[model samples]
Every structure is written in structure tokens, then in C-alpha cells.
Target: MLEKDRFFEKVIDRIDHLDRNGLKNLIENLQQKQRVLQLVFEALDEGIIITAEDRVVTMNNVARIILGYKSRQYGNFQEMDKYIANWGLWNILKFLHGEEDIRKEFTIHQQQEPKYYLVEKRTIEDNLVLYKLVDQTEKKKLQFQLKNIESVAALNTLASGIAHEIKNPLTAIDLHTQLIQRAVQKNLVCLDESILQYIKTISHETKRLNQILNDFLLAARPRQLKLSFEDINSFVQELLLLVKPELEEKNIALREEYQNIPKNFIDKDYLKQAILNLIKNAMDAMEKSSLKILTVRTWYDNGRDSTAIEIADTGCGISPDQIQKIFEPYYTTKEYGTGLGLTITYKIIKEHQGEIQIQSKPGEGTSFTVYIPIHKGHKLLDRPL
Candidate 1:
């Protein structure tokens, strides 16, 4: 037998000879150890699930949350029938029932966003099977965003050059057309009414093309941020005040929920432009809706060391397909939209090393959240701007 087995046996043999005090001390020691083990189990970040040889199932709170199990514990696999049926874990549990170890990742759509988990199943002592799960959602999102930023940078570089080439000709046409119109008005030239109509058409088309090019340049070009420390809540409040008249004119109900937030290094002009574009889009979306409500919320997450602004509107919500393409250059659903508003907003956030998150449902509502890092004086003292 092992040393631990011999020690246990010796203790068991001496148990009867021990007095009441000795027994009480031994019980207290065991209880303390049991409590410590429970604390460690609950404190773990990974989800833990253990199944005994007799088919009894034990799980921690994290495991229960990951599996969407509402109960405390399960006596057997049969006790998990309800969750197994709904969670699509029937096959996974079945495979886990076997002797071999299995490892895989699962992507579960939970309400607004999809969550990713890396699950590993292996056997422990006494025929106890253990399943460990680690959340991988944030890791996946960061990887995807990095990849997207690279691709967008490449595309914008190419598009910027083309837009620059086209702008010169458009500007020339616009200016010369204006000169001709001036000459005709001054009676220095004679033209038919049909020719005048053609001139008007050319001028209108030229100006429209010029506006599109301007928007494209704004969206694609790199900008240097004029960083300054400002209170996020106050910044949002001032912006709401600027738009309050329009909101009142359109009978749109406005709500502001501002929590205490830390000041951060930001470009006031760029950030304001980004938020204004989102607010304008929200108002446009609600113009046809019977119930119009716009909500602006600002908060700070100390754990993330970031501050956030969320703009939610009760209007025509975006479809899943449109949400994916909403930030793409020149992709717009509005008839008169230049399609570069969100793109510029995205670019501004990216320039600040920030991120934007959006959630929407068809016929429901949409929320756009912009997150920027919280900066402190000491942290930025040695760090480069």
C-alpha cells in the first residue's frame, strides 16, 4: 500500500482510542479542508464538471452557467435531460460518457452575441470524468478585429489614390461650368434654353460627385488626433444639448443616462463628429416610426480600464446582413446616404486605438457602443501619445 494509505489506516485504528476532544479536533480539521476545497472550486475561472463512476454529476457555478443549467446539482445524466434537450449537448454528453478523452470548441449563440468556449474532457482518478471549459469569446473577437483592420487598411489605401485622381477632374468641371453659367448670365455668351438645361445638369452632377469624393477622402485618410483630457459625461451632455432642438422639433423623446466616468485623452472634434453621425442616423431611422425614442448612455468600466458611450434608438432596426456591412465604404441603405458616415466613425475610433460594438434586431431597436481607453496622468507620463 501507499504511504498515504498506511497513514490513513493508522489514523483509523487509533480513532477508537482517542478521547472526545481529539475526535472534535479531527472533525474540525476535515471541515476546514473541505471548506478550502470548496472555495478553490468556486474561485476557478474555468468551468468544472465532474461525473463519478456511479453516474452522479457534480458541477460548479461556472459550469452551470456555461451549460445553461439552472439547477444546483444533478444526481445522474438523466437529471440533465431538460438542459441536454435544449442546449444541444446530448451528443457531447454521450461522447463524454465513453472512456476516451475528447476536446473541442463550442460556439453558442446566447441572445445578442455568440460566445465561444474551449472544452476539454478527460478521465481522473476513480473513474471520475472531468470537463473543463474556458471562455474564448474575447480572444476570438480580438483576432477577427485585427484581421479586419488589416484588410480595411489595404483597401482604403488603394481607394484613396483612386479618389484623389478623380477629384481633380471633377473640380475642374465644376469650376468651368460655374464660369460658363456666369458668362451666360452676364450676356457675354449666347446659348439655347436646352443648352442651359444641360449646363445645369452637368453642374449638379459635378457637385454631387465632388461631395462623394470628399466623404470618401474623409473616411479613408489618416488623421492626427488633437488629444485632450475631457469628462466623458459632460462631453455627451453638451452634444445632446446641441441636438435637443432637433429632437424636440421632431417630437422624439430623448433620454440620457450618464454615470460617473473618468476623463480620457481624446480628440474633441473627431469624437464629436463620430457621435453626431450616429445620432443623425438614429434620428433618420425613427422618422417613420410611431414610437420614437433615443437613448444615450455613458459609463466607465474600471475593470476594462475603458469608458463607453452607447446610443440606442427605438426605430427601424438593422438586419443581420446589413449590420455586417454597415461600416463598409459606400454601403448604405438610405436613398440619399453618402454611405461614409459609419466608415469615418470607425476610422476615428481606430485612430484612437478604440473599438465599436453594435447590436441590433429587426423591427426591434439598435444600439451602437463606442469604447475608448481610460487614461491616467501617471500612466501616460512615460507612455507615448
Candidate 2:
């Protein structure tokens, strides 16, 4: 009976040892997983923070920088709470603790600048709360710009309707005025020379008005694009030739940097009009500069899968406040300007399913870039200058 009891005791002792080994292995595995999770949090671009019930437990480096608390220790809840409260992050904390699911985006004013953030909070197991922050200031700015574009587009449609209704009558009036002037020139019956001169001036001014209306109508209306395959470099070169005399008279140096561009789809006439408007604007902007220089460049933008045409000028750059309104119809900074040039340019580029972007700073010059897609079966025409 004693030997049997000893044998049973040895078996029980072996079982206990095995159980201890299993627990040690499980603990090591859990530590490895925790280390991996920490590395992942550090590597993420978006800021991340974790809280255990009411205290800050951990934060990634991105979170530290975003909150302007880089020197803070990992689990410093009291200090973090202070900073968060000062920066208006207390609302976010309340949302996390509350019963509501919190996901919101808002702008925080910082030193006269606005920073946008997308905040999200979710509760995980063990009463842990995770807070994620995404910076979206630039994206928000772009969205605002796009909204402005849409408003302008709607205005363009209304203007097009008005212009179409008025154009026919204007044309008829111009024709009649010209005919009456011709009759006066031929008859000269009891006609005072001053009256004749007045008639001639009226006729000329009417024709000028007609021409301006035509330009406005063209800008407001959708263009019928005659797409063709053509080398963008050659196309721009031809355009430069047409504008060479004007540039030469102003003493503006024309610089061309053409990359090896593949054949792209474009409408010859419409593309020329857009390019011409851009170059003319550049010339006008540089009128007062000591070195009146206009640079034209064409290249492929790999990220966009499109061809880009850039017109840059060493000119009196636009003010930041006024830059946003430059593309609006009938908005001009120059005297005797119709303000239709840029409006027309923008419309034509949009018709081509392209995008136009302008970057300018006060006293730093400006650059206008137009990006158009590259596709097959586009058309090109050689027009007489």
C-alpha cells in the first residue's frame, strides 16, 4: 500500500510541472504580441492615443507631436488631460466616455491659422478607449475651392442663357448701323462732316460692342471640342509664334521648355484659345517688372496620368485674398478689361475634362498649370494665323 501511494504522488508532481511550463509559454507569447502592437502604433501616420478607463495609458509619437507634447511620458494622464483641455480636446474626451458614438470633424484655431482634424473615438474591451486623429486641413481647403468652382459653373450656365438670347439682336443692330454708315458715305446729301464722323464712330463702336459680346458668349457656352492626336510641344510652339509680336513689343523674354511629350488628345482651336489667354495674362502681369519673363513648359505628370502645360511669369503676383476670385466671371483688376479672358480660359479647360490650378504669392510671381488627359483618336488642325 505504501509503494502504490508513492507512485501516485510522483504522477501528480509531473502534472504540476507540465502545467507550470504551459503558463510560462503563454506569457511569453502574450508579451511578443504586445510588443508588435506597440511597434505598429508607432509606425502609423495618423495620430493614435489610448486611455484606460479615466487615465491616459499610451500614445504614439504622431499623437505626441500632434498634441504638441513630445516630451511627455507615455502614461502621463494628468499632464495630457491638461493639455487636451487647454486645446479644446475635452469635448472629444466627453464624447468617448458618453453613450453616443463619436465621429466628427472640426477646425481648431491655432495662432491665427486654422487646422482641421477628423476625430474618432471607440471603446474597446477592458474599458480601454481609443482616439484617432486625422489631419485634413489641405483636403478641406481643396473641397472649399471645388465648391467655389461649382458656384462659378452654375453662374456660367446662367450667363450663357442670357448671352444667347441677346446675341442675335446685337448682331442685327450692328449690321443695320454699318449699312446706315455706308449710305451716308455714299450719299453725302446735306450731311455735315461732323455728323458723318459721328455716324462713323457710332458704327465702329457698335462693331466693337458686338465683338465683346461674342467673346462673352463664347466663354459662357460649352465649346464643341474637335479632339485630335497631336504633339503638345509642337502645338504650344505654334501658339508662341502667334503671340511673338506682342511679347516682342513689350520686351518680354519668352522661354520654352518642352519635354518629350507623347501624342495627346486636344481640340486645336480651343486649346490655342486657352493657352493664348494664359500667356496674354502673364504678359499683362509682367508689364511693370524689370525682367519681363514668361516661361512656357509642357510635361507629363505621372501621378495624374495627364499632360501639363505651365505658364509662369516674373510678374507682380496677385494678393492672397484676391487670388480666390481670379477665376470668377467679370472679375478683373485691370482698367479697360472685360474680365472674360480667364473666365473663357477656365471654361474651355473644363470642357476638355482638364483642371487648371494657379499658385501665386504677393511679390513672388505666379504659375498657372493646366492638366489634360492623354488618349488616342484625338484630332489636330493647322490654322492660319
Q: Each prediction's TM-score against the native? A: 0.59, 0.60
* Tens-digit lDDT track of model 2 for 69-112: 64556554555555552265545555456555478887777777
CA lDDT, every model vs. true structure:
0.84, 0.79
| Candidate 1 Cα deviation (angstroms), residue 115 | 4.6
- Model number with the top TM-score: 2
Taking every candidate in turn, the Cα RMSD to the unseen true structure, in Å, is 8.7, 8.7
lDDT of 1 by residue, 1-385 (tens): 4975885787799998989998898788878978998999998999898888646477787777766776665777776666542264444665567647878898777568887888788888768889897878899999999999999899889988999999998889999999999999999999999999999999999998898888888888877677778898888888888999999999999999989888888888889989998999999889898989999999987766789999999889999888889998788989999889999999988877778999988787889999987754234334454
lDDT of 2 at 164: 77
Best model per lDDT: 1
